[model samples]
Target: MEYEAATRHFAALGHPGRLSVVRLLLRHAPRGVRPTEIAGTLGMKSNTLSHHLAELEGAGLIGSAREGRSLFYTVRLPELAALIAYLGQDCGRGRPDLMPTHPTEIDMDRPFNVLFICSGNSARSIFAEAILRSLGGTRFRAFSAGTRPNSVLNPFAIEVLERNGLDTSGLRSKHVAEFEGPEAPRMDFVFTVCDQAASDECAPWPGQPLTAHWGMPDPAKAEGTDAEKGLAFAKAFGELHRRISAFTQLPFDQLERLALQQHLDRLGEA
Candidate 1:
């Protein structure tokens, strides 16, 4: 980062309002928030929020994307990281404690709680919960939920899990709200397993959990004979299994938050 560029970034965040905006955006990283929601959450007038957003974007501290009719804003993590690095460039000279450490380094002794989400809790998300439950052993606790959940679990999904020797007795469809309340478990990670759910406006999860989109084809929408539908569900199961297996094998204690997030986004592509 050039000194000039660093100065620009600092200038953008110099205002109290702008700094608050940046903090809120960081909490919702990887999931862009719409301008209306930002305004509502921060109690800022639309005109004022727009000015701040423009300034942040001009400084490359934030970025936006058009999703359908809405423009969503997200913090540019790499740029922010560069600014932090520029500030702390010489921290190791004498202040070893001032050097940054990975968040997971302090939490490695406890099991991580992971939540998988989808449009319907019936299929893909459920498959993920089961796969992680079986593969993660005591190192991870997996949960699943939906944005608009069906009343019952998808039969084909259950069939596929049973065929693969996974327990299905306790699995059922659940709303995302179930996990959003004050009483809900704090999640270490949250993943969206379908494109529709990924694009939906989700409530800000408690704990500001690390999130990623891991979209897969919806097997519940699969049309064919029972055998073919079962195959579709089985394929979904395999894909989630592969992803979760890779996730469990990650070196959490060694990777920083940003690096861990990058690995998660890459797994979605895989």
Candidate 2:
């Protein structure tokens, strides 16, 4: 970072309110926190929180995105990394112990929590959840939800899973809100398997999981004879199986956050 840039970031952090905002954002990390949540947590009035957020954003310490009716603020990891590097540049000269270390590994002590989302919890997202459940073994715990979940799982989706020897007894459509509460499992990754769900506004996930759009055509929309509709569901299952298989093969312990994010985005295109 340039001297001017470093000074600007330092100036931004000079205020106690701005520093507190940064700390709160860091706790949320990759996932964005809504302004209301931030204000509530910090006990800052709306106008005061807005000013601090703007200052931090202007200094490149944070970024924001609009999701439905909510605006979410997230820490700018690269910029934060650069600022830390600038501050610790001299630490390598003699005191290596004082130098910062970047985390390249994810916690492996517990099974990684994964969520698959769609507009309806009927087919694509359900298939993904099941595929991951079977293939992921003890390494992953998978869940699925929808923006506007149907009353039940799509019959074709269930048939396809059964034909492939996947368990369907406990599977059911679920609203995304079910996973947004404080008691919900903290997801490590969340994927949207259809365009509608990818574009829909969703509640911010609890853990601010790494997210990506893995959109595919909705198999339930197929109109044809039973065999043809079943074929469509089968095709959807095949695509999801391929993606989830690739996801499980990633070198989680070796890739850092940015690299892993890039990998996830590319998987959507694949």
lDDT of candidate 1 over 1-270, digit per residue (tens): 788998899999999889988977775566677899788878899999999999999999999999899999999988998888776764344354665544453278789999999988998999999999999999999999998955578888888899899999799999999999889999999998986676566777766678888877898888989888888888899999999999999998889887888899889877
Compose the digit string of candidate 2's lDDT tens values, residues 191-264: 88876675466666654567777878898888989999999999999999998999999998888777898898
Per-residue error at 118 for model 1, in Å? Answer: 0.4
Q: Report every candidate's CA lDDT.
A: 0.86, 0.85
Against the true structure, candidate 2 reaches a TM-score of: 0.63
**How many steric overlaps are in each model, in order?**
0, 0
Taking all chains together, each candidate's TM-score versus the true structure is 0.67, 0.63
User: Which one is best on lDDT?
Assistant: 1
Candidate 1 yields a Cα-based lDDT of 0.86
lDDT score for residue 262 of model 1: 87
Model 1 regions lying over 4 Å from their true place: 1-106
Give the Cα-based TM-score of candidate 1 against the true structure: 0.67
